[model samples]
Target: MSSAVDTLEQSEAYMENPKLQKYFKNVWLKEKERWVSMYRVGKMRVPVGTNNGVERQNRMLKECHIKFQVDKSLSGLVKVLHKDFLPAGYKKYIDENALASDSYRSYLNYIPPYLHNRPPKIVKHCMKRLNNASSIPTDDVTRVGCTVFKVRSSESLLEYEVYFGSESEFPKCSCPDFKKWFLPCKHMFAVFNKYDDVSWNSLPKWYSDSVYITLDNYVIKTSDYNSLKQSDIALSR
Candidate 1:
């Protein structure tokens, strides 16, 4: 299994295990006993790889519910959620994404330039996993292209697809964490740790930029930013 199609074929076989097939069929297969590819449904391209968004919404709702003094009818609850909860949540989400993007880029300006273009979280995770000398969680890596690999987990004995890209492309792992939460999994980071050439620059666009905010107007002048940064450092010293 070299291509993505081959990976799917392998996944089918893996899912065919009696116990595993039953669970996947009951939970994910849908319709008849036949399993359908989500891609074929045409809406699977959205960045949502997990239920974290729904989970977050549920948490927020529960918290808000606890603070309410009066009981609300179903319609009243819907009205409050629409008129209050969603707008505030939307604004907070936007501000945070923009702030995070600006801060990360600003951080890059002051930090050791050798770190390249990697996401801080991914770099931290990679170093942590490597320094701890965690057993290689994956084996049987088969490269399909310059940037794609199919690998198998030693624990679940399941296969996953991984893709690493150049500046124009973003890295992706077929694992649930990467797919659902849009975060790099240890498996993806392990690939980076194993290879010397793959660096932060190989990350997908979302890893470096705000997925929710545009950074075009937020570019900082290195000279001015660096001068202020150095002055701040001297003051701290």
Candidate 2:
């Protein structure tokens, strides 16, 4: 178990209830290699940690579409869901209404240079995380060194260490996002927020580069793909 996992497992007695123990043993424990660590999950760059986010969005869609007497045909519904429901709700609730909140409006304008080349989805994801980090009290962030800090979580009462390394090394966090995915997690952002000097320039190269390029390979060698094949050279035509 130790060899397969980077972190320690919860205590055996923590799941002592028979029902909880059975589920933990049969499901979570058995699948520990896949989901136990943030490192494992982060490498995949999965946009979701759980289906709840999707489910919640879907529920919102249903409420908005159904209550408003919108078109019901499958195609019409799909179009309205995107073109009407989601966008409208986002603009009305999150964006337009955001002007009322100083913090929200500030976050909207706060874009980093490295994020400029990223896809819109990735930008939004980072923004969401940044917003979350903002909610954490700045006083909770304790600097230990020029490049290291400890962030105390208000809700969980847990402390995560963040390291903003140099050119030879990327920034990292003791939290799972840094440990496994190599991406800066909210805790790292919280520490970064404390500094006026920090920007996406401090981010790992992998974060700003397109993830699709990382996932797939495309090679065109001058001697191979670019150069004519021997058979083509030999052909009379």
Q: Which model scores highest in TM-score?
A: 2
lDDT (0-100) at residue 194 of candidate 2? 85
Give a tens-digit lDDT track for model 2, residues 77-140: 8788778887766444332222222222222235664444333445555667777898988899
* Deviating ranges (above 4 Å) for candidate 2: 2-113, 204-237
Clashing pairs in 1: 49-179, 49-180, 50-180, 118-200, 170-204
Deviation from native of the Cα of residue 34 in model 1, angstroms: 24
Models 1 onward score TM values of: 0.38, 0.43
Model 1 C-alpha lDDT per residue in residues 59-126, reported as the tens digit of each score: 78768742583657788778768877887675554443333333334543433333323334434444
Candidate 2: RMSD to truth? 16.8
lDDT of each: 0.52, 0.58
